[model samples]
Target: MTIAIIGAGVAGLSAASDLKGAGHEVVLFDKGRGAGGRLSTRRASTPAGDLRFDHGAQFFTARDTVFRALVSDLETRSHVAKWTPSRVSLAHTGGTWSAEPLRSDDDWFVGAPSMNSLVKGMAEGHDVRWGERAIALSIRDEGRYVQLDTSGWQGPFDAVILAIPAEQTRELLADTSPVLASEAAASVTAPCWAVMLAFDAPIKTGWDVAEVSNSPLSLVVRNSSKPGRGNDETFVLHATPEWTRANVDKDKEKVAEELSGVFCQMTGAGAPSLAAAHRWLYAKTETPANSPYGWDHAQRIGIVGDWRIAPRIEAAWQSGHALAAILID
Candidate 1:
């Protein structure tokens, strides 16, 4: 069977890998320049030197057996590694900041060189059309088809799987399947404002990761503390969803200034040599679709994403893995 999977993220890549391994012809289409989706990295050049940041997702944990096995395989292949960082929680009260150790038993993993390396490794040997946004989906006398912004309609496939965000899935499925579209609409996601800071020298901090409260920042990570990252002192700060939504329309430069100030205040760090901000309209999932995946077997159309189950990276893999199993059956 010829299958077309849209969105080359973990979920889409997971499904494509499984379906293709099962002897089905599978192709993936993504709007991004490459794969990775939320598991992304940003590289910047600074006067100090070159720096990289895992700006999208800091790290992922594998709670599921299947996902753990996959992570183990990637680790063996040198595409992934375990990240052991000192974690702490910061709180502000009466204009005073206090820090406490944040402990977790879960094993945290990150891509070897960058967060996107995991997805890029998964995307190997697959026909993925990058920068090709899927604009529409149609049902014809022949079979299901997808319309791309640049390439027009490409299809007659046995099935079409949507592995994109919920809002985008709704837009594509509104005409193809109203029921599925409504399901997609029910899922909710929140925006985020991320600030990447590059320092000439390492900041004096005992903890590598900090969860902040009573501030505009939610997470602050020393990106250089991760495995395989260089000696550059880079940090990634994620603003709270509420803060991001409130200042969604603010200028990027202003956002960077504001967040950098908050980071300095929280960490007692000096001004960064380089600071940049990235806005994610749909950064984190708030309300999921309450299902592993949505499959309209009669129409041979399905939807899978982290929003279909949980917001974790493992959930994205599980959703796609489960959906592909159903399709293969």
Candidate 2:
């Protein structure tokens, strides 16, 4: 069978890998210049030097056996590592976020160099057509196809699999498949404002990570504190979903200044002289479908992503894995 998979992220690539291994011809497309979607790493050019941040996904935890085994294998191959951060709380909810002597135990894992590295490793041998954003969907000559922005339609495939973000999936298929696209549109995802900063001097924030509230900052972490990264005094801050949604339409400069200010206030660190901000419209899932994946065998269409009931990198993998399993069956 010839299959067309959209989005070269973990979920899409996972499905493509298994589909091809099962003897199906598969073609994958991603809007990104590289694979790994939100499983991304941002490299900032600073006068001090190049600072890399796992800006998209801070860290991922595995609670499923299949995912655990996958992580273990990645670890054995040196693609991933365990991160035991010296976690801390705000201590005072309303007041300043000076870190106190409070710590919590958690098992956080990060990709060896960056979170995207793991996905890139997983996509080692797959043929992913990059920068091919699917702009529309259609069925012609009784075969499924997606039209790319520049290249036009790409398929007459036995099946079309949408592994992109739910909102994007909805936008692409809204006209051709209203019911399916409407379902995709119904999945709720939160926007996030991520600020990446490189400090001239080492930071004095007492803790490496903090869960903050009552302020614009939602989560703040010293990226330099993570494994493998040199002690470069780098930090990444995530704005609360509420704040991000409200300011989602603001200009990048305004967004960066405001978010960096809140980060300074929360961490008690000085205003960063160097900084950048990114907005993720589908940053996190607030509500998702009850099913792990969706497939319409008759229509030769499948939708698989992390927009299911469980919203995590693991869930995204599970969604794609389930899609491939169903097709093979």
Candidate 3:
């Protein structure tokens, strides 16, 4: 069966890989220029040099057996590496800020060069239509079809899988399958504001990653501290969901300035030579779907994403893999 999988993120790529491996023809479509939805990287030009930031997901852990095996294989292929950054927890106390050491036994893994490299590696050898947004879906007498924003309607595939965010899946399924659309609607997601900072001199914070409390910012990472990243004294700051939702409409420059000030105050870092901010409307999953994946046998339509389980790369992989397993069965 020829399948149309939308969204070239981890979930979509995972499904496509498995289905194609099972002797089915699978094609993927994404609106972005490349794969990796939340597992993304941003490049910034600075006087020091070109800086790379894993601004989306800092790092991911593989608990499931299947995901662990895949990660082990990627590590052997030089596409991924274990990240052991010095960790710290910061909290605001009575007129003072306190920092405590954070320790975890669970292994953390990141893409060798950038977070998106993981998905790019998984998306190898697949027919992926990049820079194409699937705006609508149609059902003909032959099979299901998808309408791309640029390339008209394409398909007559046996099945159509939505591997995008919950809201996006809901919108796409509203007309095709209302029941599946309602399932997508049940999942809730939150927004995030990310700020990338590059400095002329390195900030001597001692710790590479920090989890903050009682602040607008949630997590701060020294991007250069990660493995395989060049030495460029770069940092990525992620704002709290509440803060991001409140300031979602603010100017990007202003958002960068405000977050930069917070970074300086927290770490005593100097003004960044380059500061940029990005707004992610569907950044984090607050509530997930009831099942691992949603499938409507009558319409041959399905939905797979991290929002169907937990907000983790492993969950996203598992969701897609689970859907493909059922379909193959």
Candidate 2 backbone collisions, by pair = none
Q: In lDDT terms, which candidate is top?
A: 1
Q: Against the true structure, what is each candidate's TM-score?
A: 0.98, 0.93, 0.98
- Backbone clashes, candidate 3: 0
Candidates in descending lDDT order: 1, 3, 2
The candidate, 1 or 2, that scores higher on lDDT is: 1
Model 3 scores a TM of 0.98
On a 0 to 100 scale, what is the lDDT of residue 43 in model 2?
83
TM-score ranking from best candidate downward: 1, 3, 2
Off by over 4 Å in 1: none
Angstrom error of the Cα, residue 112, model 3: value is 1.4
Model 1 score (lDDT)? 0.92
Candidate 1, residue 174: how far the Cα is off, in Å? 0.8
| Clash number for candidate 2 | 0
* Candidate 1: worst-modelled 10 consecutive residues by lDDT: 45-54
* Model 2: per-residue Cα lDDT over 1-329, one tens digit each: 99999888878877987899999999988888885678788888877778888788888877778878888988888888888777666644656444545453546788887888778777777878888988877787868888898799877888999998888888877776676787788899999999888888887766788877577887888888777888688888888899998998999788888878777766567878688888888988888987888776557788888886566888888889899999988
Q: CA lDDT of each candidate?
A: 0.92, 0.82, 0.91
Please write out the lDDT profile of model 1 over residues 161-267, one tens digit for every residue.
99999999999999898888999999999999999999887899899999999999999999999998999889999999999999999999999999999888877
Query: What does the lDDT read for residue 239 in candidate 1?
Result: 97
